[model samples]
Target: MRKSEYRISELLDRLARLNQSELWTNDLNPAQVAALKYLMAANRFSRAPSHVADYLGATRGTVSQSLKTLAKKGLIEQIRSAEDKRSVRYDVTKTGHSVVAIRTNLDEALAQLDQNESANIALLLSNVLHSTLAARGGRSFGICKSCKHHDKSANRPYCRLLIVELAEEETSLICHEHDSAA
Candidate 1:
């Protein structure tokens, strides 16, 4: 790899490690924390265990175990899908929301950056992530508003792919079926 590429990869690795270290709190491991955070940011359609596994790039078994631990801690609860009896969805509890509200060192550091700098960094990182996921044939799991299926020209935002109307707030959350407009 080029020197710049190597440096970028190394920096990302170190930052990820630091972030993971800080996630170990409230008697929860990094995996559980990640699951909770993802659920909190995910829309209703992406709350299933399968979607969680896809988002984490982890095995269903691994995701299942983490979910079980979260449930045991009262951080998440399972809801039976009314449309599909066999389908189960996970929702973050109030406790989970509180846990996610706790700011980490990374958040504090990022908060120090100016808006322009932060936005530029976010765009660059998002591009990198999209390229990586494309290469690996992984799901984008991007925000609903950024997906090609999102139709905002109407009175209400709708998902053409899902053939359903979306709440204004749901338009900002992530979705497993997201197809990037880019």
Candidate 2:
């Protein structure tokens, strides 16, 4: 690998180590916390174990295990989907929200950056991630607001892909079907 690539990899490794060290105070493992974080940010439509697996690029079995653990901890609840009773949805409970709300070392570090610096860093990382995912033929888990399928013509925005009028709260969420807006 090139020097820049090696540096990037090292940086990511250090970040992961920092996360592990910082999050050790919490009872849950890194995977569980990641799931909780994903659930907290995901839209109502993307709250299933399958969605989590897809987003994390983890196996279905692993995602199922993680969901089971979260449910056992009362951090998340399983409910029959309102639209489809056969399908089950996962939702973070009040406790789960509180758990995920606790700031980690990475969060604290990012908070130290100025608004402009943060935005720039985010943009740079996003570009890197987008390109890397595309190269690997991986799904780009993009935010709904920047998706091509987000129809803003109506007074209330809707997702053309999902064929449902989106709630105001859902507009900023990460969507499984998200496609980048040109």
Q: Rate the local accuracy (lDDT) of all candidates.
A: 0.94, 0.88
TM-score of each: 0.96, 0.93
Candidate 1 stretches greater than 4 Å from native: none
Q: What C-alpha root-mean-square deviation, in Å, does candidate 2 show against the real structure?
A: 1.5
| Cα error of candidate 2 at position 15, Å | 0.9
Clashing pairs in 1: none
lDDT of 1 by residue, 1-182 (tens): 99999999999999999999999999999999999999999999999999999889899999999999999999999999888899999999999999989888999999999999999999999999989988989999999998999999999999999999999999999999999655
